[model samples]
Target: MLSLSFLCVIAFFAGLVDAAVGGGGLIQIPGLFSALPNVAPATVFGTNKLASAVGTLSAARSYLRRVRLPWRLVLPTTVAAFVFSFVGAQVVSLIPKGVIRPTVLVLLVIMAAYTLWKKDFGKLHKPVEIGRREMAIGLAIGCAIGFYDGLFGPGTGSFLMFLFIRFFAFDFLHASAAAKVVNLTTNVAALLSFAIGGHVLLAYALPMAAANMAGAMVGTRLAMKKGAGFVRVLFLLLTSVLICKLGWDLLQG
Candidate 1:
């Protein structure tokens, strides 16, 4: 029988992967579905948010302490992401997820292709002018990705890092830091919505959360030590894995 112990083990590794590259759901969501096959889908998803939130938050804290993340942009980006995530969660009940998955798969494919082709894509940190234009762009990125998180939510962190690097000219390290902040906000938004709907299962969530925290600490520390080049390589690896995962889901659908 699949027990809470087994789930916690999975959560730990998910935290490690998620902290490093932002696709922890690629490991976690499927684990939830497979381990607790009889559980209600809402309960499963809710528990996932709770468990993953702890690890994600742990990673965020670790990154903030070590990385000189830009708070000016992160603050606004977080707020925008939170509001849009709530909006996305609300919309999830009204729509079928099928249409979105294929679209996301295609976009992930393009993102992967671009990342692979551009050898020095996220290597350098180029600070941009912080103005109305930058703020507006940050807001747009936050809302767009946040909504996607609440709606589909597998590679939210990866998407955030890539976009920050691509548009804002941030290095992978800073982009990952920024991504953690935005991702944390989205998780909070989604978790609240799930809890309010009485979907969260605390028994399972609590244990997994603890395990995730442990993994998060290790992963975050490793990322900080390795720097942008390491992060860039890991990002590509995770993106490719995500593409495969999403593609399989689309095919099965």
Candidate 2:
């Protein structure tokens, strides 16, 4: 097993990355696998969720204090994400994620390419006009992304932010804030699923969670200071990284 310090360091960075762009699992999951290769994969995943959920909770709260969260999306998306994530987790074992991985890779690639090409995208912060159809679309995005979080388990935050920009016309800062709320709901639901199955390792999760929370606070502050433009850049960078990461996973599979 890796030392406590090593684990905390990993969690800290994981929280930072996640708070910035919603791909914190990209770091924490691999770190956990490396640290506890002998442990059951489920336990490692659960532990990662616990630590990340705490960090997300902190980031979400921090964001709310500074930014006005889009309740229109949160009201529909948060509930849908929570319920569908649980459903996704329940069905994950029956699904072949390897088959799903390639499809996700293609989507991520397209998303990254489009975002990179669009210079003014996510730069303007304006509230969208929400009608009944808009509300349904928001809920659909939440449920679909939430289900994907449970079934495939990567890039959930990035997807949320991207969809918010693409569909709802939210800027990066607002999108990131809204995404955190949705991400936290999905993370908690998934964590509960693992906990019920007796997969979480609290011994490691608790300590790492402390570090993750701290990292989240720091990241939240940085993102706030940098504004939507900085977040736009970071979002694109992280999406590209996710593309490569999933592509590599597909190749390995």
Task: Name the runs in model 2 displaced over 4 angstroms.
Answer: none
Best by lDDT: 2
lDDT of 1: 0.88
In the range 95-211, model 1's lDDT, one tens digit per residue, is 788888788888888898898899988899986867888888899999899898898798799889999998788989889888988999999999999999999989899999999
Summarize candidate 2's per-residue lDDT along 83-177 as a digit string, tens digits.
99999999999988878888898988889888888988899977678888889998998899999998777889999999999988889998999
Task: Give the lDDT of residue 167 in candidate 2.
Answer: 83
What's the CA error at residue 210 for candidate 2, in Å?
0.5
RMSD of 1: 1.3
Question: What is candidate 1's TM-score against the reference?
Answer: 0.96
TM per candidate = 0.96, 0.97
* Least accurate 10 contiguous residues by lDDT in model 1: 65-74
Clashing residue pairs in candidate 2 (N, C-alpha, C atoms within 3 angstroms): none
